[model samples]
Target: MRRAASMGMTTPTTPVAIDPADLAGVFDRYARDLLRYCTRRVGEQVAEDVVAETFLVAYERRDRYDASRGEVLPWLYGIATNLLRRHRRTEIRALRALAHADGGARAAEGPAQRATDRVDAERAVGRLSAVLAKLPRRQRDVLMLFAVAELEYAEIAEALQIPLGSVQSALHRARAKVRAALAEGDAR
Candidate 1:
């Protein structure tokens, strides 16, 4: 045992010299952020799978990762975004399901305030979904990453592989469209 220990035969080889503990810490810290981003991009139901695939891909490609470039969050965001793009059909399906659920009229209950509040919340989310569907993919992505994922413009640009200016422009256009839709609804 002493000979094996001295020879380092019992030690497992990792891709890099970085300690596995450090890697685990990094994952723990960022996992929730990545999961939230995935949920917003796709839906909560598929978010777990997207996050698992993202981390798996990141691990496999760890050798090529450049730590000196910047923080790992943006790189991970880029990976998650790419995965989300592949599942656009699923996202559309989720949106449609939400819209259908929202299309039904809610039951009025005079006695229960909580039930009324829940119905109102669902109605608002459904309206938002309807508006979100009308946005171009890039614009919708930028809007969600900014508002839901709470990513900075530079991070959004990196994830979407767009210019920083494009991120700003896309968000501006997306917000304007959403506002116009809300205005039209109010007018009605």
Candidate 2:
């Protein structure tokens, strides 16, 4: 090995080919679920790019995966979370934008007061979105992983690379704030 290094000649290690089937299997198993999770954060338009980058990163770092730690979904979510950080401001803006959105496309054309139910629902969602936007990043992440991704506390911890206790506390705080915001009244 030293002689080879000194001579700038490579040792003859067998090259391993990545199977197309394995890649297909991975994408098939998790793409839809990951897409839904991504869509909820960044909207449908940007979700595809995020998921694609996630799989690309996962494939590039395949050597780092440890099956003993947990399942693939959590790992994939972990990658998604890291990638989402780059879009954090985008998410906040989207949520704020959504809050201001009419939010009741199905309602019949009329003055805003005519659709009381629609107005109420819109306000409710606006409050919720405002609350979510105000949450600390860690708390929001824990909440999203648990609420949207349907991961358990342990899985959330693994995904976010945080302690289980931290996950529990962050989620707890997030829920409390949301509940309070929703209960308080309209977003206006």
Candidate 3:
């Protein structure tokens, strides 16, 4: 007698197909956010290209996605991060420039009464840039994923395909360096 499928009966599972159309959904859902993430890391000019390349790669490798592993965003981030590594020098320079420019913009936007605050802010930016420049590439990638991308530790782990402990370690090391740099500046 044939048992009903729900009654602990074995059923043949069909393979799930990766539709090309789903790539559009990925783009629609993630493109703008990925653009912002890339822009923060690499500046506007390279950001667009990076994002475009990310989606192109994603589309090409769509079949490799395994739902059991994690979600699409982390996968996209991993791809983007790998791409960013190829442009590491450019990214570092852009970040330093952004740090300086952002600090000046913030200072300029403040009231005249806050001039002293502006000067402090600018000094902090300079120190931060120097510290970031000195940080190891892995540490910087992890730190930026945490601070700029605002990814959780687990998300960072998944995106970088590193162990969670490694993520924590990298962040701790990065923060320690930044703090040390800031302390030196304070002592000056």
In model 2, where is the ten-residue run with the lowest total lDDT? 1-10
Distance from true location, Cα of 13 in model 2, Å: 24
User: What residue runs in model 2 are displaced by over 4 Å at the alpha carbon?
Assistant: 1-21, 102-116, 186-188
Task: Please give, for residues 14-90, the per-residue lDDT of candidate 1 as tens digits.
Answer: 32322333455556767799898788767787999998888888777765555444556777788888889899888
Top-TM-score candidate index: 2
What is the TM-score of each predicted model, taking all chains together? 0.80, 0.80, 0.79
**CA lDDT scores, all candidates in order:** 0.73, 0.78, 0.78
Ordering by TM-score? 2, 1, 3
Candidate 3 lDDT by residue in tens digits, 105-181: 57668776667776777878777877887899889989988898778898889999999999999999999999998
Error of 1 at 180 (Å): 0.9
Candidate 3 pairs with clashing backbones: none
Stretches of candidate 3 off by over 4 Å are 1-18, 96-114
Superposition TM-score, candidate 3 onto the true structure: 0.79
